[model samples]
Target chain A: MLTAQVLYGLTACVIVALGLRGALLHASLLQRVVAINVMGAGVFMLLIAVAYRGPGLPPDPLPHALVLTGIVVAVSATALALALARRLHAEQDND
Target chain B: MNTTNLLVFDGLLLFSIVGLAWASLATTDERRSVILFMAFGLVLAVAWGRLLAPDVALAEAAIGAGLSGALLLAAVRKQSPGSSHTHANPDRNYSESGAKVVLQWLVTLLCAALAGTLAWALLHALSSAPHDTLPRAISDNLVASGVSNPVTAVLLNFRAYDTLLELAVLLTAVLGIFSLGQTTPGYQPAGPVFDGLVRWLVPVLILTAGYLLWVGAHAPGGAFQAGATLAAAGVVLRLTGRSRIGLPDGFVLRIIMAAGVGVFLLVGLTLLLLGRPFLGYPPAWAGALILLIETAAMLSIAATLLLAFVGGQPQSTAVNAAANRQREENSRC
Candidate 1:
């Protein structure tokens, strides 16, 4: 069971790598946005996966709350990024 | 099949999550990638649940899957007419694509090696960090706090400073969005059928948001979840054209967006003045004070999210009339 938990952490690590690959090699800005978000999700998984030791324990509430805060921050950042993209698109349309 | 074999389920879920993310990011079609991204968000909710953080699962589903998906769709749609993707030409650049394929392989190898090292450390090494240390402290102090939920206590009590800064961060993002563009139109009004659906859904959403906020003190819900739920309702109304997305700049709008931080400042300062060390409320009054802070936070979060999505103030009356005309014509067809 602990090995399963470690596997989950490894999966998260892979997800982050996939995201980094997308962010770097992709030509599209939208793809980069998607990639960055995927990386954020992996970070979340890693944090929670590490905190979760076994089934019956109370689990770490600190990371849960921190993840919640992080999610909100991530959304705020996403909104700003999308707005920037939208502005650029509109300008291109006008031209 | 052993019904309680959670490890099996966990393995499957991790596979699907990684696969879905890969498809979403690797696909070339803009619309299809976004659709896959939305599915990825829902899977994220399930993953958080498996991790035993239902509070996060709820927030993730609403904000991550629901709102973010809708926001991305709207942004994509805004560029529908003669759209220009970042990679404007593909077939013309065969050599460029070939070079990119080589670079991709190298990056993948590097990332895999890094992940393997971390996995080994987590499983075999990394000793002596002390388990249950902070948890003991939190539980020891939990009774004195008004709420029994450890997570809620920590967020609003022990580490209130972090939550306070998060509220400010949300505010700053909204303001940064406003500076990006002034005339960007917010939402598109679909047909009357969809409009009817939105009308029926809005009230139910508002009620649920309130219930979630009230339940957060001792349950797996809180201001972020409640606020995100409320923001989803506002987004629906905007899409239906029943609500204004780009309502003009005014006194009311400004105050509502900044209200969360304002209330946080007042609460913390009041506690400091009372000689209880900033944000340290009286033992007996902590519960009531947290409830109050959460209520303001919920309202402010909803308003801030709406503004951030809209990006800027409404355009002139003439532009509004043109949009209305366009909607009417599209619906007729």
Candidate 2:
């Protein structure tokens, strides 16, 4: 169980870094949006890892609930960002 | 599972997750990248399941992987409006200049440092004996929280204020999308085969959404999962060229979008009036109250997600129906 936790936690950290690199380096707005989501997923994964107790024992419900809320928030944020991007594209077409 | 076996599975899952994320970001093409990201979400969902978070896994599958993929794909289609097969990505060769390459290296180093710091801190935290206080507290109060499921109890009872605020955030997002502009012209009507599929798929999705909502009080399902499932039905309907997507426009749509937050606030205030703390339900009434809140929340979540997928406020169905009739008459002429 400890091994699983550490592995996932470390993996989450790496994913977050990769996402940050993409968000900073990518030129396009859409790619940046995708990068941000990847970062959010990493954070969620980390929370879930922290919440894990053992193979049979029920994990911490607090972090589970927190990650659930985060997922919804992340999707909404993605939607809003994509809307802004689309509006920008429409405006650019006019220009 | 034994330690070694579990370790191998964890390693493989983690490897695939990181690979998928990297591949998704590395691709320059928007459609390819979004598709890869969706695949990443699915794999991450599996990881969540492996970590023993069935609720989170279900949500990741529905909202994270499914609906978000649909939204991103729709945005990609809009980005390259003229053709289904888009040309090479405009952002494809970004590392040409010397200055850009130097910046890229610097940024990469910074991210690596961030990852190293996080991992170091995580290892230190894990090395210490685990804290059992909070989890113990949750289990103690689990019965009082009114739901048998600890996660549901936390979301709906113990930490309900957070859930309420989360609903507000969702509402804020949909409102932002609506303010941007009208929705894109919808898809063409589905062909016969797809139409038949929709007939079967939509009903099953709706049934599942209802089942998830009811099962949430005890199991791994809840308002968010149920709401996303319901929204999937709407998305399918929208994709099949149904402009209305079963949504009543104007006042009704606004109400549905606001329902989650509105119901939550109303319940909180009512409980306060009854001399309980905000969102603190009496133990005896807690289960019923949570169910009430979850139902309203389910409706609001479904509306918000469907609208977010649609990308903007839709025009009323009346105008849309009249336009369709006019077009039909013109074709006859």
Candidate 3:
């Protein structure tokens, strides 16, 4: 159980780093948006790993619930960001 | 499965998840990148299941992987190919300068350091004795929480304020999208075959959404999942060139958009007036109250998500006129 938890946790850390690198280096708004979502997914993986107890035992429900809430919020934020990006592109077109 | 098998499975899953995330961001092509990101979300959903979070896995598959992909794809489709504005400004040559390369290295190192620090912190936290206080309290109080599913209990009862706030955030997001501009002109109508498929598919999706909402009290489903499924039906309609996409006009649309937060706040405030703490439901009433709130939330979430996918304020008057013309033509036929 511990082995699995540590493995997922470490992998999540690496994924977060990759996402951060992409977010910072990528110039496009869409790539930045994707990068940010990736970062969020990594964070969520870490939380789920922490919530895990073993193969059979029921895990922590708090983190599971929190992550569920986070998923919906992430989508909403993505929608808003895409809308803003579209608006920006339209404005640039008029100029 | 046994420990070794589980270990191997976890290893493979995490590897693919990381690889997919890396590949998605590595490309500069918008459509390809978004498609890869969607794949990443699906793989991540499987990982969530492997970690024993079925509720979260369901949500991730539905909202994270499914709806997010749809929204991103729509945005990509709308981008006018002639305008290089939305694309990354790849025209600027960064490789020509030594300082720029140095800055890139610094940024990479900084991100690596951040990852290292986080991993170190996680290792320490995991090594320590796990905190069982809250979980124990939750278990002790589970019977009175009015739901068999602990995650749903937490979402609708123990930490309902958080869910309430989340609905507000969703409301705010849709409003922002509305303020941006009008929705794109809808798709060309589906052909006879697709039209036949949608005729049956939409009803099935709506039924599944209802089942999900009802089953949430005992299983790995809830308002969020149900709402997303419902919104997907709307998306299918919009994609098939339905002008109104099943949404009501003007005042009713705004009401549906506001329903989640409005109903939640009203319930919380009413409980406060009854001399209980905010959202503190009496055990006998808790189940009923959660059902009421979840129903309203599901509607709002569905409307808001569909509206978000539409990408802006849907022109009600124009859509109504178009629908009326279609109706006249059908009557004549």
Candidate 4:
């Protein structure tokens, strides 16, 4: 019988697998974004697992802060990328 | 580990990733793919929360998933329908040779093996470590910072210097965007109805942002999170045409821009005067000082980010109209 942690680990593995597949197989820009996001989610899940220390240990707060910062930075980067993409599309349309 | 719960969570995460991969692989339409990508971001946010990193989860949801999704969707809307359908095939010039296929497989295998090995090592190290120093330090210092959340202590006290630098990075990003000169060009001016909406929403957003900032002293909320929310509201207003993009170089703008850095610098100087180390918070006043600095920092950051998103010169009316129109369309859809 697999424990919850083990099952969660499996989940993280599967998510990573899917993210790699998506990144490798997909060519569409939006799809690439989706693949990256999926990968990010997997990494977050892994971080969560690391933070989980038995039943009594206080949860890790550093990871939480780091992840929060990561999320904000990720969004800002993505927004910038999307803006660039829009401009690229516009330029292509004109061309 | 409970086998059933583990299995269920594993299944959910696997299914989500696979679904995202399938969507990415199957979709030829760039627009749809972008939407799917945003969905993937949201799911990832949920996963982060489940992992016991609530702060990360909140940030991911608001900034990563929410803001990015909005930006992407806006970009998509701006694109001409026909341009979105064009697909650039990478393998177009490549001959379908056996050697190429073999090379690809070999590369993939190598990458996977390396990743697997790295993960295994990390897992082993995490499980076998005799003592975790980082968590202990944070817990010990949590009360001194007058914050219940150890994460807050780490961010604001133990590593306040890092937080200060991060704010600087944010300011630089805004400057970079200004140099781009694309400031809110696509956004239209707002109408009378839009003004009414802004009047109702802006105060509420400001109030929420204030509460979030104050609670961050002992809770999950903080300056970055609150600033982002405030910026979101500003972005909304800019999009709707209620708020124009000014030079952000104006006197007020300059002050707001410097406020975070200024407060940080002043606080460090004040501590130095008291014979404490630079960036060290004094025992009696750590909470009060941190809150004061953070409040200023939040305001500065919020304004800076919003200005960055809008591009350059603040054009209030046109941008607001466009934002309002877009919001109405989004709500309807």
* Candidate with maximal lDDT: 2
lDDT of 2 at B116: 98
lDDT of 3 by residue, B1-333 (tens): 888898889889988998999899888888889999999999999999888899999899999999999999888888844453345566552444788789789989999999999999999999999999988888888899888899999999999999999999999999999888768657988898888888898999999999999899989999999999999999998888878678888899989999999999999999999999999989999888998999999999999999999988777677657857865775676
Worst 10 residues of 3 chain B by lDDT: B80-89
- Candidate 4 scores a C-alpha RMSD against the true structure in Å of 6.3
Task: Score every model by TM-score.
Answer: 0.89, 0.95, 0.94, 0.79
- Quote the lDDT for B230 in model 4: 85
In the range B26-134, model 4's lDDT, one tens digit per residue, is 5656567767676766776666555566666666666676666666656555554436564546573122578867765764676466457646754674657535688
Candidate 1 or 3, higher TM-score? 3
lDDT of 4 by residue, A1-95 (tens): 11434445545655665566556656555556656666666666666666666444567787677666556555555555555565565456456
Q: Score the docking of each candidate (DockQ).
A: 0.65, 0.78, 0.79, 0.43
Off by over 4 Å in 1: A91-95, B1-4, B82-98, B124-130, B186-189, B243-249, B315-333
lDDT of 4 at B217: 79
Q: Itemize residue pairs with steric clashes in candidate 3.
A: none
Candidate 2 vs candidate 4, lDDT winner:
2
Say which docking band candidate 3 falls in.
Answer: medium
Q: Which candidate number maximizes DockQ? A: 3
All models, RMSD in angstroms: 4.3, 3.6, 4.9, 6.3
Across residues B1-333, which tens digit of lDDT does each residue of candidate 1 receive?
Answer: 353587788878888988898898777776777788889889989988887778889988988877777767767666565564434246532236667667667877887886777677666542435377887889899999889888889888888899999999998888888788664454557798998887788889899999999999998998999998888887787877554643335777788777788888899999888887989889899999999999989988888787766666555578668868866775676
- Cand. 3 Cα-lDDT: 0.90
From the highest lDDT down, the ranking of the candidates is 2, 3, 1, 4
